[model samples]
Target chain A: MITIDGVTKIRGRTRILHEVSFTARPGRVTGFLGPNGAGKTSTLRVLLGLDRPQAGTALIDGRRYADHDRPLTVAGALLDGSGAHRSRSARAHLRWVAASNGLPRARVEEVLDLVGLSADAGKRAGRFSLGMGRRLGLATALLGDPPVLILDEPVNGLDPAGIRWMRTFLRDSAATGRTVLLSSHLMGELAETADDVVIIDRGRVVAAGTLAEVVGEHATLEDAFLDRTASEGVSW
Target chain B: MTGPRRVAGAVHAEAIKLITLPSLALTVALTWALTALLGLTGRPGGVLVYTQVGFLVLGVLAATHEYQGGGQIRASLLAVPRRPLLAVAKIVALAGIAAPFALVAAVLAGRPGATGGLLLDLVLAAGVGMLVKHSVGATGLVLTAYEIVSPLVRTHLPEVARLPSSAWTAAVLLVAIAIFARREA
Candidate 1:
């Protein structure tokens, strides 16, 4: 479970997030929706303890991410796929991250296989297509098999097949009782996989609830998203 | 994760990443090639001089690549969480990787008792690399600093005090990399 309460983040003189609050529950996939620059990444950073909130708290499983003894085992996250060295092979890239958290070495191969990148594991990451890179990033996030998964644009560069694999993987992970918070601009995809939705516009929660509750009579979540976005007139 | 252990893991991960980059291999190869060329030309002043340039480049590339990625800074912060601890891990790892190469160069260059100074140069290079975050620029600054304190200019200084400028170069490199890597952009 993740709880963010009254979080405020100020970048220089500009306020990025103002008293934003939300909760992600176990056994459900929560889609974190926001326009670009709406503090989505900043909020994720705070939740991961990468950035300190000026006036509130961001907690995971009742404690800050930094406070966890085995952080990877509590929450696995992939904020961006470009975190690894481009010249390093995919397998080598995953090896170091897994080893850093004392995760078993075999976990590297397992995740590579899980992401269906085992065939290209030895190839340099720089040579990978954006889709392949996303898979490698997912493999890294899944290395520790934590109870919570936080992914930002996990399907940014995936092909249709890869997207299907990701959706299935996320649903299965949530079905196993893991809390999943996935952020994306792809509303239809989110509507298909997300059990809950948290919508943010200009850094504040505009709406949040079960998918059925949030969608209402919009016919589709994309239409609902467009409605909320247009109604708010918030340009990210 | 808590205390020194997590820091150690962070450092280890950083070190592996440091060494595993093809750039590191290329830099090492370039250093040996340059050293051998300088040797043939009878310019084997000190091992510190031979290795400083390459390691300095390593330092610059290491930090800049992360900055360019737009995510390493955040990932590193998430992994370690403590500013000073993370800074220490980065500096230590950079030094650990550079020292041996500097040492080998010093031995090959036949600079008697210059291995220690060469290690110091590595530290300085790492610091500078952190600051400039550009291998070419960092290497230039290190070279400039080296020339300023070279034996030719500081002849009146004590033989030990006149230790190759590369020694101080490493120290400066450490301080630079630490400040640059840790500071909020």
Candidate 2:
């Protein structure tokens, strides 16, 4: 389970997250939906302990992310880019990350196969295309086979087939009881894959609940998001 | 994992990064090559002057490499969230990689005072890199510092400290540790 409560963040005098409170339960895919610059990445960063919040807390299971002894085995996260140095081969990148978490070296190959990047194991990360980079990032996330998965715009760079594969992968992950929380601006994508949804606009949670609850009488998730965000020229 | 074990893992991971970074091998080779060139010319004096440039760069890149290639710092911090510990592990790993070479460079320089700041240059470079996150900028700043400090720190007895006062050192050390731990990834 993941809990973000009253989480507020400020960067350079701009309030990026305002009392953002939500919960993503195990065995459910929570789609954190927001438009560009709407604090999705900021929230995820705080949850992962990559950034500090001035107020409130973000918890994985029951403790802060930094408090975990083996955080990778507790929660796996994929943020922007490949998360590997450009000069490093994918295999080398995975190996070091595994070593940091005290995970076995074999998990590197296992995750490479899981993400279908085994063929490109020897390729340098800088040489990867957008789709390939996403795959590499996903491979890094799965290195520990953690129970919680947090991703930001995971399907942003994927091709159609890749997108389909990711959709299936995230669904299967949640089906098997992992807590999956992904942030994206793709409403149509979220509508199809998300069991629950949280919509943020200008650093505030405009709405959140089950996918059905969020969509409500609106024609689709897109409509609901547009109705909430595309108005009054308010973007902070 | 206990604190020490976790630190060990971080250090291990950091060493692997330094080993596999193509630039690391290149930097070390260039430093050693220049050391050899200076040795052959018999201009390798008590303190290595020209060759200190390579060691300075080695340190800066070692510290700032995580901020490159779409920022590996995110992945690194994600793996080891104890930010201060990560920073310390990074330096420890850099020391491990550079120590043997430092000894080699000292022996090759064939002078008593040449070994004074071989690995210390890398640590200094790391501290500068932390102050300036950009590698190019950090490298330039570190080199510039080397230029200014080289004349003063010519031998083993003379030391040029970035923060000479203990109080100032403590203040800067606290600031650096806070930045490493609390800065946004």
Candidate 3:
């Protein structure tokens, strides 16, 4: 389970997130949806303990992410690229992260195979294409097989088939009772995959509920999102 | 509480990172080559200076390697969430490499410098790289201070400059540790 309560973040003079509160329960996929620069990444970063919030707590199973002795085993996170140094191959990269968390070396090969990167396991991360990089990033995230998985822009660079594969993978993970929370700018993607949805706009949670609830009285999630996020400006 | 096992895991991970780095092998090979060539050419003191530069760069290489993928640092921080422990693990891994390399370099170069000092330089350079966040800038800054400023300051405070290389390295390393612990990954 993941809980983020009253998470307010201020960067420079601008308030990036204002008392953002939400919960992602296990056995379901929680889709965090927002437009670009809407603080999706920022919130995920705070949850992962990469960035500190001015006021709030992001907890994985009732404890801050950093409080766990084996954080990887508690939560597996993927943010931005493959998270592998350009010089290191995929297997080498996974091996070290595994060693840091005292995971078995066998898990590395397993995740590589799981992500369909076994053929390219020895390839350096820098040489990977965008799709391959996302696969590697997913592979890394699966290394620990943690109960909670947090991903930011999880399908940003995937091909259609890869996208379908990721959707199925995420669904399967949730079906197995994993708490899977992912942020995406793609409304259609989230609408198809997410059982629970939280919509953030201008750094605040504009709306949040189950997909059917949030989509009530609207044609689609896109319509709901557009309706809720129509900001104080000239409209087209 | 983080057990010794956790710390060992972090350090082992860091060592693996350094070992896998292509630049690390290049730097080590270059340092070894310089130690042999200059020592054979009968410039014992000169051998140490060159060896120092190579190891200093090696330290920075180990550190800067973390910052390369942009997300690699995040991955590391996530793996070992205790920031100070992570920093210590980095230097520990660095020292693990530099200590043996220093012993060999000292033997090859023959009395040009102390092995302890050589190892300190390499480890300190890694700490500086953590602070500077770039290989060239961090290593260059340390190189300038140790090579250029020390020599210039030595003429005025002969005893101070001669004695405090380790002290200066310690100060840099301590400051770097504090920054690494406090800074956002």
Clashes of each: 14, 0, 0
Q: Report the error of model 3 at residue A225, Å.
A: 0.3
Higher-ranked by TM-score: 2 or 3: 3
Model 3 regions more than 4 Å off: A234-236, B44-46
- The TM-score leader among the candidates is 3
lDDT of 1 by residue, A119-198 (tens): 99999888888888788777877888899999997878788998898899999999999999998888888988999998
Over A143-195, each residue of candidate 2 has an lDDT whose tens digit, in order, gives 88999999999998899999999999999999999999999999889998999
TM-score of chain B of 3: 0.92
lDDT tens digits, residue span A87-185, model 3 = 899889999999998999999999999999999999899999988888888888888889999989888988999999999999999999999999998
Worst lDDT run of 10 residues, candidate 3 chain A, spans A227-236
Q: Write the per-residue lDDT of candidate 1 for residues B1-185, one digit (tens) a residue.
A: 56667877778877877777787778777877776677667763444465556655666676555554425555556555555665667768877787677667665666647666655555666666667766667778767866665555567667667555665664665566456544653
DockQ of each: 0.46, 0.78, 0.74
Q: What is every candidate's alpha-carbon RMSD to the true fold? A: 3.4, 3.0, 1.5
Error of 1 at A97 (Å): 0.8
TM-score of each: 0.88, 0.93, 0.97
Docking class of 2: medium
